[model samples]
Target: MAELIVQARWLVTGVQDRHTPIGIDDGAVLSRDGTIVATGLLDEMKRLAPTATVKTYPDHVMLPGFVNSHHHVGMTPLQLGSPDYALELWFAGRMPARRIDLYLDTLYSAFEMIASGVTTVQHIHGWMPGGYDAIHGAATKVLDAYRSIGMRASYCYAVREQNRLVYEDDETFCAKLPSPLGEELSAYLKAQAMPFSDFLKLFDQLTAENQGQRLTRIQLAPANLHWCSDESLVALHEKATAANVPMHMHLLETAYQKEYARRRTGKTAVRHLHDLGVLSPRMTLGHSVWMTQEDVDIAAQTGTCICHNCSSNFRLRSGIAPLNAFEKKGMTVGMGLDEAGINDDRDMLQELRLVLRAHRVPGMDDDDVPSCPQVLKMATESGAKTTAFGETIGKLEAGRGFDAVLLNWKTATYPFQDPDIPMLDAVMQRAKTNAVDAVFIDGEVVYADGRFTNIDRDAVLNEIADVLAKPRTPDEISRRNLGRAVFPHVKAFYDGYIGDGPVQPFYRQSSSV
Candidate 1:
């Protein structure tokens, strides 16, 4: 019967039918066993739970912690030697990434996320060289890292069956290559293949292994349309439905990916997935950057969710997602810092501001652009809907988990702030890591002031530095050589691959959908 109470100067409970949060000045929250029981004035909370432990923040503004709905790895791809190539070429560029231990790698990003008020992550991990056991071990390490640091993680081992290198099939593409590169690439893809049933088995095993975990949940990922066969995609959708989990599949991330979908199925990615019977509330499309008007209609009608990785699109040269269009259609949208953010790190505070400002489409159309509260909803409640944890962990309300962030009001509004500006708007636009006074998840404070409560962040970073400071392993050297050798062919595969014509732009303001 552990009870905790946070008496804060202000409490942002949640957003309702308004453009601002449902806030209370001089408010408090009472929780028992990690679930919020009541929210009201400080005196009311104290009367309700007199025996609860109280933590007071006199000059802080409390809000729900954010959810990063789509993520891949801990370290950024750029940090691992991959240039800011376009999405298609970036895959080849990432082939030679130096290895880092999965546990440490997960922590590296978790630290950044927590510091910026991100409490949960949809950690989509994949592209391993070993079979089921190896992949499962890797998944365990990632999960362990999240648990060790007290952050919540909805983890899914991304399932990639084909298209190991380019948009072409593995066997077809390998046959076109010359000399040892052919055998080398084939062997590499072969090492990653397993019976499709094994993927389901792995999901079941992970679910069982995480039955009683509060900080962990297991979900499914189909990797992407080009990487998954139709049969496997259907099977994964069925499995996820039966297991009561969500699927975050990367689709139409780039113009080339949109082209691939059309070439393969003679239809848009959304249409193909809809025909396959996979589009539903349970399916979350990672990046709908190049979706057509019809695609938006399909996604809206079928209740398919969207994850707008704003910075990832810019960094990879993927077109900006028409987020305003999605909102206009009443589609649920979430924010994700895929691969890396605009600044090449997982700072959700920075990511939030980027999303807020990026979608202003150069017009004074009141309803066409996103508002401050709308972006906040995307980061919190809508983002939670994309993961296995659902909407249960996104808001501050009765029956919801007690996860929140407290920002120093002075720091958030330092120097001078206009009284006409809303508190959330002022904070979103100006606050940085220094304003992040505390982060709470599951009724417990995991990060406070300048450090993680559960782990020594500096020690872990030094450990990573020491490991990388050593000479590259023989395996790493070989992969680097292979990447260099195959770079030319990989680039050549997309030579005039995209048909030049008037493709649909990011979005149209007024659609009848």
Candidate 2:
């Protein structure tokens, strides 16, 4: 019998097309027990729920909450002492990160994401060094952190069965190094190894644990094309199909990964996945930055989805994803901030602007580049599709979850805004994190006026600072040394991996004028 009504100065229910978004002036949404009952004019919504509690913001604009389709750890790799090395080298570079409490670490990124209006995250968790029970504890802590803060999470333990580092097996790579270093690295890799069945068991256990969860669900991840053996890929895909969940697989993130696929399968990564019958609507490929034209075509034809990690691509030298091409092929693509946004945080507002402006190919054709509605779609409904929530949580419509963000339109447009410019366009261009007035998930105010409702942001941040202030443990120092000693060897493994072949430049349009 619980009910609440939210009214805003402007409301964008969802997108209509590449150019139009279905919005209402003085919009309001009425929800009962976290499920939307109606959306329309403010007066109309009030009439529909006369006795319900109402929260109105006449100077705010409400839109569906953003979904970060691909994410990993709380602290960015850079903060952990990993420079912006290429994706391959960065794996080794990340070894220097100090161990921090999982709950505090999760809150660190959750604070950033929620402040920037991200209500849900695809938390792809993995690469732990321990047995199943230890990893299970870490996973529990992550899920608990999100739940405690009222953030929706679609969690997955990235299934990394082989190729622990580089594109070769761990044993082979360890053998390449000298003693002690080799022995130590081999032991570290072995500590993370468990039977493939253990991965499935973990999934089942996590799934059972989340049977009645309102804010979290377990999903599957194959880690990447090079990390997973073909048999593991097929098994994971089959498990996902049987369980009716989505699988987010990282594929062809770099040229070296693409080269690795060629060496392993004698074909492109996309083709190899296709040959194995793993491409489907239930599969979301993360950072498809190096897919061939044919691969894009196959993905589109098979109804597969893509997550464009715009910031990660830039930070890791992973090259630009063919976002324009994906759109031209009528494919569904979601936006992912990945490690961090352009400014080194999980700012979805900034990520939206980056996605909108980043793909403006030099052209005069209006449809050639991304439009406001297209980018909004990617951030909302399309992004939701790639996660376990799917269509259930996107768009502010009846029968959907009441998850949304209320932005302070007055401040966002403070100074002046032209009437000729569309509202959505102007807001997207001018809005920033400071303008995020409040965030709603499941009809509850999780964040409002720069404050979180369920957790103490400052206290958690200070606790994190206190922990990092203390000296690193002995194990951390040992791992740091191992990471340093193994850097050069790891870098040398990719020598001529992609070959010194001629490369094609961006296609010159037949006519610019």
Per-model RMSD to reference: 2.4, 1.8
Instruction: Report the number of the highest-lDDT candidate.
Output: 2
lDDT of each: 0.90, 0.91
Residue 81, model 1: Cα distance from true site in angstroms:
1.1
lDDT of 1 at 194: 74
Candidate 1 structure lDDT? 0.90
Which digits, one per residue and each the tens of the lDDT, describe model 2 over residues 391-501? Answer: 989799999999999999888999999989999999988999999999999889999999999999999989988988889899989889999999999999988777888
Error of 1 at 20 (Å): 2.6
What local lDDT does model 2 show for residue 486?
A: 95
**Candidate 1 lDDT by residue in tens digits, 1-513:** 999999889898877742768889988999999999999998899899999999999999898999999988888888888999988888778888989999999999999999999999999988888988999899999999999999999999888888878999999998999989988978877988877888889999999999899999999999999999999999999899899999999999988998999999999988999999999999999999989999999999999999999999988899889898899898889999988899999989899899888888766776778888888889998999999999789999999999999999899887899979888888888888889999999999999989999999999999999988888899888888888888889999999998878755664545668
